[model samples]
Structure formats: C-alpha cells, structure tokens
Target: EVMKQPGTNVIEVADAVLAVLPDLQAQLPPSVHLVIKDDNSVNIRKAFGDIRVTMLVTLVLVVGVIYLFLHNASATLIPALALPFSILGAFTVMRVMHYSLNNLSMMALILSVGFVVDDAIVMLENTVRHMEAGESPLEATLNGSREIAFTIVTMTVSLAAVFIPILFMGGILGRLFREFAVTIVSTVLISGVVSITLTPMLCSRFLRVVHAKKGLAGFMDRSFDRLRSGYGRSLRLVLRHRLAMLAVFVGVLYATVKMFGIVPKGFIPNSDNDSLRVQLRAAQGTSYYEMVGYTQRIADLIKQNPDVDSQMANTGGGSGNQNTGRFAIQLTPRATRALTAQQIAQQLRGPLGRFPGFRAFVNVPAALQIGGFRGNSSFNLTVQSLNYDELYAWAPRLEQAIAELPEVEDVSNDMELKSPRVNLIVDRDGGRTWPPQKCQALEGRALRVA
Candidate 1:
C-alpha cells in the first residue's frame, strides 16, 4: 500500500519502514497484521551488488591486460594509478551533480574504465618508446608528453563530443542517459588531465633505463612485431584494391541496415525482479463485498502454487475505481522458484480466465518506470476527444481491435459506463402545483438516492 516518492532511494525508505515496524505493530490492534508483500529494494540491492562486482573485475582485468602488454611492473603501475584518480574524480563530479550510484551511472563508469585507461596508455607508450631509443627517463617523459600533448587533448575532446548529443536528448530516455553521458565525459576529461600531469611524472620516477629483453617481455615484443608486420601488409593490400574494399564496406553497411530493421525494437529491455502484479476488475457497480470475495478467491488460487511467497490485495480503493482490486504479489527468489514470474503469470491466465463477470490482468512490473508510464503494462496509448459519447463508444472497440493483433496482448481500457443506475425525469413547471404532503414520501426516498 506504500509507494516511494520519485527520486528517493527505495532502500532507504524500506529501511526506515523496517526500523519503525515494531512500534507500528505495537500500536495496531491484534486483529490486524502487517506484511511486506513486495519489496523492490531486494531487487535493487542484488542488481547493484552484481554491478559492483563487475566494476571490480573490470578494473582488475584492465590492469592485468596492461601488465601483460607492458611486461614491467613499474610500467604497468603508471597507467593503473590513473584508474583510481579518474574514477574518484567521476565520483566527486557525481556528488556535485546530486547523482546517486544508480544503474545508469554505474554502467557509465564501467565503460569509462576502458576510456580512462586509453589516455594513460597512450602517454605511457610514447614515453616508453622514447626511453627504448636511449633517452634518459626525464628526457623521454618530457619529450614524449610534449610530442603527443595536442593529440591527447584532441582525442579526449572528440571522445567527449560523442556523448554531447545524449545530454540534450528529451523525454525519459534522455533523462536516464544524461547522467550516463555526463559521467563518461567528466571521467574522460579527468583522465586526460591525469595522463598529461600524473602519468609522465610517475613514469619518470618508476621506469628504469631500457635493457635487453630476455624472457616474457622479449617473446611479447617479437609477437607484436609480427602482428604489426602482418597488419601493415593487410593495409597495403586494401589500399592496392581500393575499389574492392569500397564494395566490401558498402556490403557491410547494407547488412547493418538490414539487421537493424529485422531486430525487435523496445525502449527498455525486460528484467526479472521476482515479482508480479495482478489487477482485477468486476462489472461496474459490483459491491465492495463482492470484490473482496473475488480478491480472496484469486489470492487463494495463486497461493496454491508453491512459488508464490506472499500477496497483498485491496478492494474498492487505491486504484481510483470502486470495482477494481489490486494484488501486489511477490514470488520466491529466482533461485528457489522453478518458474520465472512471467511464466507463472502465464500459467495462471487459464485458471483466472474462468471467473465470470471479472477481468484479470497478470503482468510483471516494468524494469524501469519513466515519467508517468509506470503501469504494469509495457505500452500506453491515450485517445482524446471533446465528446464523451464518442470516447465511450470508441474506447472498447479500439481495445478489442488491439487485443486481436498478434503482436499485442493483455489490452485493457478504463471506460466504465454500465454501472446500474436509476434515471428520473420531472416536469419542473408542473411540479409547482404539486401538493407538499403528496410528495413527502417520494422526497424521502429521493434523499436516500442522492
């Protein structure tokens, strides 16, 4: 029955609720029981925990790859140092922007791992190359930095520019990715600064004078030389057959465009949160007691499945419709349940369909709620008109048409007009002559109706 406000942490709110639960229970009557039928914070914590592990693994792999290529602990350490500085700078910028360590930002940081290291690698490689040519450590560091400083700046600016369009994007996607773009841009800028300022100093202090290669370093150098020679030959062959290469490029472009059209399109990818939502509506004017009975029957039906952990249902309120009932159903954890939430929802459709005068919709909550599009369904279509009669007539027809489409399912509409009612028409002018005593009984009934 509780919903968190937008832009607030679900975990923090859930924690606060847990902290006060004992007192709340003490204040409540013994007949009432409190339960957490659904907790989205569980999903949030698991998702972010995985992301944190990914970030750590990415950092280690990036550093490990640097060590493999450079073959020197000192050489590897310089660029490795850039990672934390750039990441810390990103964190500082995120704090300033009032951003949390949410999914989008974490994903951006993961991608920034590669970008931040690129600048440092470039500076370190150039400096190492100068040292291999017999320059002193200080001289190599200074000359190498001076030579590629402009290139580094240009590369950083160009990389940052790639995400500039995302900042100005509009709507839900824009809002979600704006933080992503800013994080990447800020991380890259900070990395470039670290490469220019910190990387060279570290190289000068840590890098020893070049000596003859003997072991793993020698083997890697030989392997790289062969790769470079092969690449050079391939490049020359492509340049010699420029027309053929152009044709290949055109073919690739055509295939890419074709595949783009063939692929299914969606604004957000589906995710499993180990929960489902059930919304049921009885015929309009159905009494609250009838709805409660229907809700209990449905709940009992769902609970018969061992996978269902708990459900919370309410009738006649919270949904803005007197005839509607809502159930926030929580399933057992994914590891414990044999079937996914979606699959269970599908299985229940047949049994739930047998209920007459009731429409039941089983849906998984959206992975991400954007703007006002937070319904259990994936898409929302709104129809507007100046005439209520026209709207009421067309809405159900449209719903039926959409439901018949092969690509669509679970289509529903909220146009209610069939509620039982009594219509009374009176002749106002003639009523002036009616005797007050004669109308007294009717007036009492009319008051009750009103």
Candidate 2:
C-alpha cells in the first residue's frame, strides 16, 4: 500500500505482528527521515534500529577519513575493529555507574573522534617504519611497538589528567560537561590500548611498505634539507644581530599592546547569526490574558502559512506567580523551511517596534545559550551606590547610557514600577473585617504606587 503525501507514505501494517518483525518492513522515503517514534509501548526495538544506523554511519565516516589520509586499509580497519571493544568497555563502565546514553553521553563520543584516532595513527606509523627498515616483521613489530608503548601510555595519561579538573569543577554546568570530559578520556585510553596491542597486531598482519613516488619523495627530502639549512642560517643571523633584533622585538611588542588597547573590550564577543530573542517584561500584576494577547500578536505572524512547525507559548505566570512566561519554537524542517531561525526571529522583532511600553532584545544563539545557562552571567552590571532610590533611578539611566552606545541594545529596567491590581476589602461589621484608615490608606498616589 502506498500514499505519497510529500512528507509521508502510509504503511499498511495489516495483521502484522510487531513482535515477530520489530523493525520497519517497508522502505521509508528519504524525504521523511524524522519518523515519529510515538509507539514506544508497542515495540521500542525500532528506535534501536535507528541508533544502529547512526552508529554505523559514524563508523563508516571515521573509517573513510583514516583510509584517505593514511593510504592503508589496515589503518582504517584497526580503529573500526577496536571501536566496538572500546564502546563495550565504555558502556560497561557507564552501566556499572548508572549512566544513560543521552545528549551529554553522545556528545562525549563525538568529542572522542580526534583523540581516539591519534594513538592508532602514531602506533601504526612507528610500526610501519620498522617494517620498511631491515627488521623482520615480528621482530620489528614487537621492538618498534615496545619503544612507542611508553610514549603512548604517557600521552594517554597526560590527556586523561587534563580532564580531571573538569570532573572536579563545581556547579550544574560542570556536571553536564563532565560527561563530555569522561567520554574524551575514556576513548583516549581505549585508543591507547588498541594502539599498543590491536594496532601492532593489525600492522603485523596487513601493513606493508608502499612505493613512494620518486618525484614527490625526492622533492620532500630536498625541501627538508633546505629547511634545515635555512633555519641554521636564520638562527646565526639573529644571534649576530642580537641588539637590533631585541630593539625590533620590543617595538613589535609595544605595537601589539597599543593595538590591544584600541580593540573593543566587552563581557562577550558578538556572534554571526542575528537571532533576535524578543522577551517581554511587563509591569507587575499584568494579567495572563494580557500576556497571551501580546504573545499571540507576536506569534500570529509566525504561525501563518508554512514556516512554523510548532510553538509552545507559556501563557501565564508560572505556578510560582513569577509573572513571567516563555516560548520554545521549532521552525519547519530544513528541506522545506525557506527562512532561517534567525530570520524568523528578525521578522518577530520588526513587528515589536509597532508596540508600546514593552522591551525587546535581539540576541545571537551564543548570547541566548550562554546567557540563559544556569549561572550568574548575562545581565552582569557593577555600580557604586549607597541608596535604594538611587539604585532604582540611576539603574535605568545607566541602562540608557549603555543602550545608546552603538554596541549595546535592548536595555531594561527591573521592578521599580508595577500594574494596579484588584484588592479585596472585607469589613465584618459591614460584612467586612477591615476599613480604609489613615495608617493603611487605600487611595490616591501612595496606594496606587504601592
């Protein structure tokens, strides 16, 4: 059965037992890769099949890169062979320690790619050199590998030691990044093992002396000789003209300092993508209806036609009465969506100029991600002051001062002002417990301000 709906092809799974064949029986169209895996209850095995595909793609890509550079099939195969063992070791350790394969864990594997392959290449190159020389295959493999074993171990331990600080670092961010650190160190150590043992074994079985092109090899040797001679001559010239070189060096250093002084200094560097994060900070006691109206007016332009996939506008003060709300919007997928996420954000920002008594901020993803991170960052300001009134009045002025600068944008003031709210009154004698008195006056400038 087939139904071509551009992004969907209906599969007739009639009378088929999912338990018998847990994977998709029909080939999926490439146009719809992001299949909705909502039926986790029926048979979640389909999810693992997707995971397997992801892992296989990772393996193949790594293998291809190795094969391209090293010019040896065995060099590629060694890591590919050892990766499963490495993953098994990693997974077993994680399982014992109760770690799940999620964003941070998967992030670790991605970060491990460079380090994991480094050790393998080093060991293989060393072993290949021995084979090319007069040494017999087994003798060269053993002795050549032994010479590099200490170096490999030292390098691995050194890399692992650097990661220790990240593990010991305090805070929620540290905890999250710790997973990435663990992944890197684990994969490096595993690669060292594969390098010393499995790499040499593979080299003993498969690596051979390949013929170097005569013109290229000759040019390389001559280039090295020239480079060596050039370095010696340059070093002699520098030593002979030490005083002049020192004067020039000091002048250069001073110029660098001057250049640095002129360079703009700030808390964080600006980013390339122009993602305008238009956040609304309304006055106190603002109704949920008011909030929803503002959000809907803003989101109305977003949700029309075809660009938006889904948007979640939190339409009330959270249960905490924080009087704040947020939205997480996902644009339509890459293949169809014409506008970049930033472009959509800019579209929202442009309409905001038409509104009054509201503040909107244009920000980059870097600014949003790092600023929104669970830390005491983003809106950091320092002011030398004595009085609370001074703080309230001067803060907005300071914000204005900063906002007026070409570099600064979307400045805001905190809770110095508020919206008027309904106040319940009760007087038991007149069917209420209280009355407006001079001590607690409920009229005019004072009550309205409060």
Candidate 3:
C-alpha cells in the first residue's frame, strides 16, 4: 500500500508511483497481474480543468461588468489588459516561490481578478474625467495619474496588509493559505504598478473625448446621474444624523460578532464531486470471504441507485483487515442527478442498516484531501494512551457520546476489543524438566491453536 507523506503533493506522489509501474511490473512473476482500481490524479486533473474554466468565466464576467459601466471600448480595454499583466506577474511570483497551481492558489487568482481591475479602473476613470474637462488625452493622463498615484499605492499596500495575518497563521491553515495570501499580494502590487504606468500610457494613446452619448449610452448616463444625486441626498441626510448612523454601525458590528460565534467552523467546506466513498466493515475476526459477501450485498444495493454511475468494491487491501472492504462509487453528473452524494448517502443508511453484524459508512470524498489522512469520513479523532486497557475502555464511551450529538453521524473507532484472544503462560522450571519429544509436541499444538 502506498501512503503519502503529510504536506506532500498528491499529484506528484501519484506520478512517482506511476513512473515506476512498468519496471515494477517487469519484476513481478508472470502469474501476478497488476491492476489500478483507483487513481486520485484523474480526479485532480478534472478539478483543475473545471477550476480553469471557472477562472476564465470569472474574467469574462468581470470584463463584461467593466464594459457595462464604462460604455467605451477603449476605456474598458485598458483595465482588461491590466488584468492579464497582473496575473502574469503573479504567476512569475508563484514560480519563484515554488507554489503549485492548486485549489487555494487558483481561488486566489479568481479573487484577485476584481482587485487587479480596480487599480486600472480607478486610473482610467480619473483620466477620462480630465479628458471630459477639455484637456488633451496626453495632458489628462499625466495630471490624472499624478493625482491618483499616492491613493493607488496606499490602496495596494492596505489590501496586501489585510492578508499579512493569514500568511503568518499557524498549523495547516497557515500552510494552505500562505500561497493564497502571497498570490493576491503579488497580484495587487503588480496591478498597482501597471495602473500607474501602463494604464495611463494606454489611456493617452487609445482614449478619445466624447461630449455626447446616444441610444443605450444616453439612457445609462441619465440613470447614473439620477442615482448619483439620490446617493448624495441620502449621504447628506445620514451625515446630519450622525448619532443614529453611529448607533446603526455599532449594531451591525455587534451582529457581525454574534454571527461569527454562531457559524460552524471548518478548515475546508465540503464539495459535491459526484463521487462517494463507501466503507464496509464486518465485526473483527470475520473471514475475508464473509467480508466479500457483505461487500457484494452492499454493492448490489448501491447499483440499484439510479444516481450511481459506476462502483468498484474490494476487500483486504491497503491497511484494511479481512473484515473490512471499501467501495469507490462514482455518481452521475450533478446536473442529471436530483440528489447530491451526501443526500444519497444519508438515504442509503436505512437500507444499509438491514445487514446485521455489518456497518457501512458512506461519505463524499473531501474536495481537499489532505495527505497522510487515513479516515473513512471527513472528521477524524484519535485517542492515544500508553495503557491499552484504559484506552480501549474509554474509546467506546467517547464514541457513543459523540454519536449522540446532533452534529455527528456514523461515528466509529478502529479499536477491536471484542476480538477473541488467547493468553499463554509457561513455567520455566516445568518446561526445562519436560522431555524433548513432549516439548516439541506441545509447541506443534500451540502453532495449530494460533
């Protein structure tokens, strides 16, 4: 069984295993056949593709929003150009830092889209305002950039500073989000530079003053004028009632604190990846064939579910004993299925309960599968003690208590305290006095008993 080291990359480990397969196969006896029943790299690749597509969609949507507000192709294009430049600079930083384009980094990239465009948008709007006041594009670019340069620098530094705490966070969260923090910070810094440099240059070259708007542009301008005036009136009224606004702000702050305490906390949120992990366990000391029978029975029931696309069941592999089996169940695409993997697993609990002396655990595979984690479910708890008797005695009570909680389900432990055991003791003096043949005979019997 191959197990990954904690903090190591899953894809890199899988690739290393695959790279040696051909040589390993050649060394094996002709009678032995090698088969790969599961490969996580395939799913990782699929997720990467999906995330890339989502990032592209986010870019397009961000650009569309910019165009809708700006109403001029040249004005919109300046920020659009800045976005890619900022991203490229961020990629360079990622390469330098030896960071992989994993989920967290990709998420940072998606979030950075808005931050990257903001700098350029600010520069473009201010420059266009100068152009509307009858200054030439070159003169407008020079004066507008000079005015906004300090603000851009301050905004960039403040935004990056917000993530500084995340960069220094301790434990697994710190390791995971360090990349996220760095990516956004680098992107923001790059966008700031681009805004102060390339943005003004582009505006000077591409921007043209338009004194009048027509059609959709004219309607949008009129609507924005009304909105700005209404907003001004509301702002003035709120400023006049300073005490009321301060009370409202304090109320919001208190509510935010309360909400933070009330919300459930987790390192990573669950995702529906259209797959489920079904773990089958029989009572300890159960034979491998008996476990196989239980596995097949569960597999048959799982096959009856229309949502299940395919499933593979196996017994006695990896760290599992003869009494344990597992099923890697693939579900149909999310769009075609009415029930999510978690919901289907919950529903299956009823039918799975019909089997006596067997426990079937169903769970969706975590979107972020941390290396070195060996748990049937997303949450794992370990109880450690030097005293075996005390540890075993306490485990069941803890498990039962946890199972009773409304938030927990399918609570189980690996302790096999019910397994039959035999204790053997021998008297040294008695064994020394025994004849050789008799001692040999006793040893043979002990082996048979074992």
* Clashing residue pairs, backbone N/CA/C < 3 A, model 1: none
For model 2, what is the error of residue 205's alpha carbon versus the real structure, in angstroms, after optimal superposition?
5.3
Per-candidate TM-score against the hidden true structure: 0.91, 0.59, 0.84
* C-alpha lDDT values of all predictions: 0.88, 0.63, 0.87
Model 2 pairs in collision: 426-432, 426-433, 426-434, 427-432, 427-433, 428-432, 428-433
Candidate 2: stretches off by over 4 Å: 1-58, 65-76, 202-306, 309-330, 356-391, 416-450
For residue 323, give model 1's deviation from the true position in Å: 3.0
Model 3 misplaced stretches (Cα beyond 4 Å): 1-37, 316-318, 371-373, 420-450
**RMSD (Å) of each candidate, 1 decimal:** 2.8, 10.6, 4.2
Instruction: Give the winner by TM-score.
Output: 1
lDDT, candidate 3, 1-450, per-residue tens = 588896799899999999999999999999997776566677778788889999999999999999888888888898999988999999999999999898789989999999999989999999999999989999999999999999999998999899888988988778778999999889989999999999999999998756798988889899999999999999999999999999999999999999999998886777887888888778888987788788889988999999988888889756687788888888887789898878998988889978998888888888776676566667888899999899988999999999999988888888878876888776898879898988787774535444
Instruction: Report the lDDT tens digits of candidate 1 across residue range 370-439.
Output: 5564343567788899998899889999988998999877788776788656777778998888898877
In terms of lDDT, the poorest run of 10 residues in model 1 is 369-378
